[model samples]
Target: MQDIENKSAPTLDQILSLEKQVWTALVEGNAQADRALLTPDFLGVYPSGFANRDDHVGQFADAPTMKEYELSDIRLRVLSADVVLLSYRADYLRPDTETWEAMLISSLWERRHDVWINSFSQDTPLDQV
Candidate 1:
């Protein structure tokens, strides 16, 4: 039996929790958690390259490159019962260097099967532009 929580829509706190989980998984190199959060058809156009959900979760889990994936000034607005938008500045310490790097990140979220998942995202270097 599936023990699912009965909720009408995602609350702001719940959305934040989902985001926190993803960031936590990234920092700890836990790809399994990431896989659970991401939709199977997730796709992204990152500065590094065109990546899919499997690419990110698998690589982050296996190599463990990214560190300290922190989100600040997080603002979320509900677009609809099933959609939400989030904006925040993300900071991270590179594994190679102990320097804090940050970027402006905007993420779109969608509720599916009573779960919140990141549908799309675009990150721009905060210092550059």
Candidate 2:
């Protein structure tokens, strides 16, 4: 990963675009697309604990669906030339629920072989007021 440090980093717009693509894949339960965006050793930390790449993909097995979602207050921190940390708030409605749930999401992306893929992620649910 350090080898790419000398390479030009991706613009914030490009990173956000990839983030949106990831959200779209999850919302649509598109395992293939999700897999493509995640590294083989990717780990996801959710309220339920840690999930590996397969576990994350298997989450959609029952089609845990979302009716709609919006991302807000997105910001990016460049950890290194080859790594980036993306933080954002996600508000979404479940297909079976009328209320919207919010979560703070942080994802770590690494540039490998000139392509960026998500290496890690964590989701913290926000308490409702």
Question: What lDDT score belongs to each candidate, Candidate 1 first?
Answer: 0.77, 0.88
Q: What does candidate 1 score in Cα RMSD to the true structure?
A: 3.9
- In every candidate, how many clashes are there? 0, 0
Best by lDDT: 2
Shift of residue 128 alpha carbon in model 1, Å: 6.6
Off by over 4 Å in 2: 1-5
lDDT for each residue of candidate 1 in 23-128, tens digit (9 for 90 to 100): 8887777888888888788776678877788887877745566777777898888787788888788888867788788888777789887668887767777673
For candidate 2, report its TM-score. Answer: 0.92
Q: 6-56, model 2: which lDDT tens digit per residue?
A: 687677888889988888877897888888999999999999999999988
The per-residue C-alpha lDDT of model 1 at residue 64 equals: 61
lDDT: worst 10-residue window of model 2:
1-10
TM-score of each: 0.82, 0.92
The reply for model 1, stretches above 4 Å from the true place, is: 1-9
